[model samples]
Target: MVAKRRQFITDSILLASSAVAFPHVAGAAQSKRIKIGQIGTAHAHASGKMSAIRSLPEIFEVVGIVEPDKERRKKAESAAAYQGLTFLEQDQLLNTPGLAAVAVETEIEQLTPTAIQCLKAGMHVHVDKPAGTTMTECHALHDEATRQGKTVQMGYMLRYNPAFELLFQVIRDGWLGNLTELSGTMGKYANDATRKQLAAFPGGGMFELACHLIDAMVTVLGKPDQVTPYAFRSHPEKDTFADNQLATFHYPNLVATIRCNHIDPFGGPRRAFEVAGEAGLFQIQPLEPGKVRLGLTQPHGPFKKGFQNVPVRKTTGRYDDEFRDLAKIARGEKELAWDSKHDLAVHEAVLLASGMPIN
Candidate 1:
């Protein structure tokens, strides 16, 4: 039995390694490709998301890109990601015939506004994370999309992560019992330029990065009653950026802490999410190329009572399954996994956790 388990683990690791090397081929068969347009390239993940859309030739057809800022357009044009794409004015892109959706990849402050315009234009929208700097705007966008029956997909990448997907299932199955505590951290070393950019926002690294983990936590724990945040500058020499921050979400029975910092020596590997419950504990470290560790009070399914490493399929890339899910939702083949109400709640909690004013 021990030998069989070892062999199975080895085989799973080898398969995941191959998947990392080669992108996952999505089996989306649509009569016509979803005509997708992109708005803005200011967001850091814009190019990467666009590249993912382009890679899935069978699912999406990039109609055009809208960049009102001339300098931003000029700068993006030289990049390989935007080399072959056509640039159009906002109205032109919104009015494009057969445009099914738009990826609102704009600056953090512009995300909600751009998404609102796209929603008003009768198109599904894939707005990037940290929906916006304000909850009111985020709620308006989500509410409008809900009324229009349009899909408003927030680009919270972990929703599609294989390990996270499994963790969700495990929790739903009651394998983890009643959740008592959850903790996560997403931090990295930043250069001076990055520090300067982050310092512009009061939330600093927490707003820029911790929002991702907060989204995941809300998915797992639901909305918390109170959010207490602690913002600190671990390295004042660097800049005024709130380089280190921690936010605690308080629930009746659970307390969750999410920490983000700018000075972890090996931040990538240290990024993690841990859930502790009466029945067991589940943790995933280095969220990308995710590795899951599980502990249980009693034997369950194929897992032993003690801690054991579990194998999850590696992602092709960050946005591989994200785009795939978007295609399915656009094609009316699948309902959005994360609906607007959930998104609004998550965004509200995120703002509070980031030490931003709700009103």
Candidate 2:
């Protein structure tokens, strides 16, 4: 078991090393690719991300997949998502040559450790949300990642969505002056399969689901002064997991609320975010299909308020924006928008809201 684990890590590390495009080397004139590795196949989203990487031939190469669990390994191998990908033992994965970075898409319990291992190896890491179970571990991993000069990107998918892009632009442009409050909701039908998959985690919906909103909240507004959570087991018999969760994060300048529940109807409101400012408000509904409503109030002249529906710019692919952004960072052409501190702060808020002990 120990040898197998070591081999998996080695292969993951090697696959993460990107081939250099030195000026003097022939055939190096082509654009360099960011070689990314995947750790653990337990995460359902891992396969989706792998497919996205595969589709983006210009940005990334899906090199190695590390699935330590026997059952998960078999399932991942047979899954269409794993087609045309190399599978390796953990140590072999870590030692893979020409590797650039690793995506820590393991079970929630393994997210932090896997990311730490990648960062300690002097490689960038993209970790899934609700980073870790404990605040101390989250901070420790973040600090180590920083010390090693690695980027620890938290997987907050909404940040890269096009509708939110316009909202953020309006706020930054000062069109919406003195933002005071913001609220966002991510609702999905937590069917039997989802319930079974999420039952493995402890914090239920708050940790498993709501972290996406919390991260978005922090992105639009800075860290909250206090985060108060009101959670419940809405479906006691459905599964051991907490099905209903809400957290109100307070800021001196603004107040934010994140609502997540496992009971949304199949075709109910998909996801939405509303930010209100002294001047006006901005809202995005059913974030997937991209419906945006932007309202602005007049400043000095005759008071006026109007709404405009901004057309949604189609994204190239699933999380493709994020992968391309990371490639830019690797090439020293872009600064890390999502930093380690932001992740620690977001996770800290989640832990606090859950009434979990924090360090």
Q: Pick the candidate with the highest TM-score.
A: 1
Clash pairs detected, candidate 1: none
Cα lDDT, model 2, residue 83: 79
lDDT of 1 by residue, 1-359 (tens): 32243233334333333333454432424568889999999998999999889988877889999888989999999998888889999999999999999999998889998899998999999999888888788889888898888999888888777787777767766788888899999999988888888899988888888888988887777778899999998777767888888999998887899999887778888999999999999999979888999999989899999899999876657897777777767877656656666687788888888888876
Best by lDDT: 1
The lDDT of each candidate is 0.83, 0.72
| Model 2: residues with Cα > 4 Å off, grouped in runs | 1-30, 299-305
lDDT of candidate model 1 versus the reference: 0.83
Error of 1 at 66 (Å): 1.5
In the range 1-359, model 2's lDDT, one tens digit per residue, is 32243233233222222212122332243377777888987665787777777777766777789988988888888899787688888778778787887878898889889889888877788787778888878888888976987787777777677776666656655677888889877767788888877766666777776787777676667667898888777777767866677788988776788887777784246678889988888888887766887778864233246777667667766576666556656665545665665677788887776656676
- Residue 237 CA displacement from its true place in model 2, Å: 3.5
